[model samples]
Target: MGRVGKQTIVFKNPPVISCAYSSVGPKEAAGPLSTYFDHSYEDELLGQDTWEKAESKLIENTIQGLLTRSGKNPTDIEFIFAGDLENQIVASTFGVSSFNIPYFGLYGACSTMGESLCLASMAIGGGMAQTVIAGTSSHYCAAEKQFRYPLEYAGQRTLTQQWTVTGSGYVLVTHGGKGPQVEAITPGKIVDLGISDTFNMGAAMAPAAIDTIVTHLEDTGRRPCDFDAIITGDLGNCGVDIAITLAHKLGYDLKGILNDCGKMIFDNEKQDTHSGGSGCGCSASVFTGYLYKQLLEGKLKRILLVPTGALMSPTSGFQGNTIPGIAHAVSIVMK
Candidate 1:
């Protein structure tokens, strides 16, 4: 593990993403990437009594499914890093507790997935761990009740509002695999442009995403075109456009190759997901399900995965505090 620039770290012997799995709800299953997801259930509750429990089950099931796909057991995992949108990250805590692996409950808002991957790569590259699992989850009902209002309220949603995805995704990171390798990571800074509208997450997170992208490119001595694609996690329609425009202003043109997991997970016209998908699961499921598959199939050689997040809690939002944005970039290269 070596520092590249101000916030970037380049792994000497990068960890390989040996296997990945995605489990999504019915709505996401009906979206554009339906065929890419590993599993989908029509029942959002997932046989659980509460939505929170269902989300926990989602993470548990995702991890189990990934292990099953990779032919590994819970005992084989050396460390587990996971998180969710729930307060105190209880979703990930309770979800993986049964596994009894050395756990690290992370909280990066929606960017928890990227943060988990960054740390997992560091642990493996720095010779701290041999095998690790990085995962995240989010639920529409749970997030609605926690962040905004209860599902029973039936409150009006603004046009800028984004639908929280009901899904979970997990990836197994190890060494010596015919899979994509985590080359480097750029940990982002907290950037607040003073946009406080809770419904408009895209506008809030765009600046941070642009900042991380610019810094990563400069640190790695590479341009946007150096990679096959540059993907952003959960930026939705509004944030993707904002980041692109901001990058252009910085003389970095990312017009054709910039893809957003939030936009790709759902069809705006067909799914009626107003702005787009925005949640931890929005990017998590898309990456493990769709993009990782592409990388393994040799469709994409190298790419930058930037997961953006809005650091705002219900208490802070109600107290009239501005939402700060952050984004972490994980550069992956396929062997």
Candidate 2:
């Protein structure tokens, strides 16, 4: 691997995404891209007693489905990088440990999908691993319990608030495979614009997304028009608009190429999802399902997937601290 420019790393032997799996809740199944997912549960609980367990089940099912679709077993995967929005990422740890693969638990909040893909691709590009799985999960109920109030509380949601996606997405990446190539990655730095409203996740994360997107473009000496799409993790409606305006000010035209997983995953009016969707799974499921198919069907030649995250905990919010934001960009292309 070689450094492209500022923060981007161009892979000498770009990793290949062999297979991808997406499983979502019923609500998500009702979305525009409903037919793309591998599976969708009829209920949030997935026959589990708790919402947390349901989230864990989502992760487990994704791993199993990836292995099944790739014609591989647990032993074939060298390592699994996964995470969730739950505290300590328990959903990932408990869900993936059963497979007996080496694990690297991550917590990039909603950006965990891009973060995991970046590291997994590096593992292959660096000749350290042959096969790896990068994945993440999030559940609406589970996230609410940890980040906001329980559903039973009937907490009033602000218009800026986004609904957490109840789903999981996993990718089976390998050094040698027949699939889209992981060409490069740009890791983002923390950028806090002093926005303290935890509900307004899009606003908090837009600057970080813009920072990473522009940096990636500058690093690679590529224009926004070069990619078929520049997709952000979960900026919803509010953040995407903010990012487009901010990127224009930076001398980048992202109007036609830009879209957000948050916006793509839900219909705010129909779903009653105020801003749109937000959570680790928002981007993960969308990429694994809809975007991956778009690539495979020859609709897109190259695309940049940037998952943005709001680095905030309940404690920080309660303490009245500003929400710091981050994002990571992974460039994927079909040869």
Candidate 3:
């Protein structure tokens, strides 16, 4: 492994994403990318006792799905790195517990998938491990209870508000595979533009996406033309527009190349999803379900996957703290 500039790591022996699986709740199953997901449950509760338990099922099932898809037993895996939006990431801890594999639970908010991928790739590329898994999950009901109003409150959502996706995505990263490889990664810095409205998280997180994307380009000496697509985690509509406008002002003109998981996960005209989908699962499911297929099918040669996050807890927001944002960029190329 070699460091590129400051924030980016250029993997000398890039790790390959051997297999991936996506499992989502009913609402996400009705979205545009329905056919891409490996499993779409009939109910949000997933036959579990509570919404939190249902959320854990998303993670558990997705990891099992990955193992099944890759034809690898639990013993073949070295470690599992994952996280979620729940307090202390119980969703992850409980989800992967039955697997009995070594694990690393993480918390990067919505950017958890990108963060996990970065560390997993480094573990392989740096010769620390040969096979591992990197993944994340999020649930609408669980997030609502933890971060906003309870389900029965029937709180009216603002137009800028985004729906937290109830889904999970997992991938098997190995030292060898013909699948997409991690070429480089740029771990982001916390950026605060002093926007505290939780409903407008897209606005709060867009600047961090811009920062990581720009820094990745500068570090690797690449241009926008270098990638077939540059995907942000959950910028949604409001945040994506801001991202394009900001990129243009910086002379980067992100028109055709820029896209977001939030924008693609659902059809806004048909679905009542306001700004679009946010949360960790929004990007995770999109990548494992849709983008992974595109890369494997050779439809997309190169892409920059930057998962953005609004780094604020309910306590922090209630205390009138400004929302801080972060984005972790992973360069995935068809090999």
> What is the clash count for each candidate, in the order shown?
0, 0, 0
lDDT (10s digit) by residue, model 1, range 140-204: 99999999999999988887888999999999999667689999999899999999999999999
- Best-to-worst ranking by lDDT: 3, 2, 1
lDDT preference between candidates 2 and 3, better one:
3
lDDT of 1 at 200: 95
Residue-level lDDT of model 2, residues 20-58, one tens digit each, is 999999999999889998899998898999998888888
Superposed Cα RMSD, model 2: 0.7
| Order by TM-score, highest first | 2, 3, 1
Per-candidate local distance difference test = 0.92, 0.94, 0.94
Q: Top lDDT: which candidate number?
A: 3
lDDT of 3 by residue, 1-335 (tens): 79989799999888999899999988899999999999999889989999999999889899999999899999999999999999999999999999999999999999999999999999999998999999999999999999999989999999998999999999999998779999999999999999999999999999999999999999999999999999999999999999998888888988999999999988887888899999999999999999999999999999999999999999999999999999999999996
Error of 2 at 265 (Å): 0.8
Residue 122, candidate 3: Cα error in Å is 0.6
